[model samples]
Target: MSLYNPNRVNPQRPKRIALVIANPATSSSTGWPVGFWWSEVTHPYYVLTEAGYEVTFFSPDGGACVADALSDPNDASGYSRHDLISQGFLHTPELLARIANTTPVQDLVSADYDALLVAGGQAPMFNFANAHALQQQFAAFHAAGKVVAALCHGVALLAFTQTTTGEYLASGKTITGFSNQEEDQADQAAWHYGWLPSGQSIMPWRIETRLQEIGANFVHAGAWQSYAVRDGNLITGQQNFSGEATARLMIEALGR
Candidate 1:
């Protein structure tokens, strides 16, 4: 007969990652349906999981989540037709179910995971920045010295998040996100294709501008380039294309 020890540590336990995605929303600036970007979530999820980390999906408001239309490979626009990773994720039942219904951020406990990642898309611009519960969870992960990462517009949360001392989390930290140039290009394409009103931008606010305003040392590469920044335990990707790079940086920070 053997007695089980409740407090025994399992050395073989896999590292867990909490991936926070934005819930569906109608973009006020463009009146367009917005949600998490396909590549932003799929790419990082692929990378992290391939590295043997257990990944869980979460959102500010849980339930079902949608992807930005243009980010879908099956979208008529063919905007993301080349995104095979996203396409595969969409086709896989288990992977697709991860985003179908997500755990609400309010239900998350920072101590339960080894790292936290926020995937970006247009919806984040409208929701993530103002979501108090999500911000607190992000801050909690940072305070716990866990790797905290964000991509594209997901970085919006970093601009408003605060440290325990009440200072902006990004203050003096080097970070990158969807840049003004990228936003301008996207808006121009939207207008040219009649998807956006003439003379209107697709986003209510720009991540780069807001982060710079908050005292973050914002840097970026050319538009659509794969660029990621690692400032201590904080990691950020420049745009959708930088997802894998960001995940790799997070893995590095985790010493895995």
Candidate 2:
């Protein structure tokens, strides 16, 4: 019998990744300027780019996207003061240049990239949830057996996404997002808006509930656990503190 040669390399080209950012939008609940969380975008941008994967930025509506006010270096919240990853992106001219100019999501089709990264923020809860166009785009990418990663509120999109086969995309996947405890802390600190109605309890509005409703195996590991979970090619991070670890996990999943 002929010897099998496992060392043979395929002629296919190397894969490229695209970072999909939420277009700048205002928070309906809080009336605050909101966009993708800084660390969620920057940390992953740094990770994927350094892995030598060509990364392109895009927004749901296509245009310049802003970072959340709390994520801004000058924000009074000071909640993200210890985020060196975000600070580095703020100061790095090259990375800054990339974000300063982003393409619209409609401009690029699923064929343009090997993977799609959905960055999160309070903005997604308001805008991304109802963005049918964006949900379709992500479903397309996931159906192709390509990687799909989302962090914090970014995973909110998964709650409504359906595969081309018409099944809930997250139906059997394990995922995580911003926890109820974090929401409580943020509301207590900012007081601009409460995610739950008075006496409604945080349980109903938790991302875990939404995912569970869609049949996902969900996990919530307290506030700021630096927890990132990978299921198949679908990756998710708990919240802001999990950004770096999430990025690293994405890098590992992409094998780049």
Estimate TM-scores for all models: 0.94, 0.85
lDDT winner among the candidates? Answer: 1
Residue by residue across 1-256, what tens digits does model 2's lDDT show?
1122232232144446677778777665545667888888887776665655666788787767888877866577686787787888888787677787887777777876788888887778877777787898888887777888889988888888998778899999988888767877765644445544454332225577788888999887887788899998888999877777887787777674
Per-residue lDDT over 1-256 for candidate 1, one digit per residue giving the tens place of the 0 to 100 score: 1123332234267678999999999888867788989999999988877777778899999989999888999999898999999988988997777688899999998777999999998898888757899899888888888899999999988878998899999999999999999999988998898887888998888888888888999999989999999998899999999999999999889865
Using TM-score, give the best candidate's number: 1
- Report the number of clashing residue pairs per model: 0, 1
Model 1 misplaced stretches (Cα beyond 4 Å): 1-11
**Residue-level error in angstroms, candidate 1, position 250:** 0.8
Instruction: Return model 2's CA RMSD, one decimal.
Output: 6.7
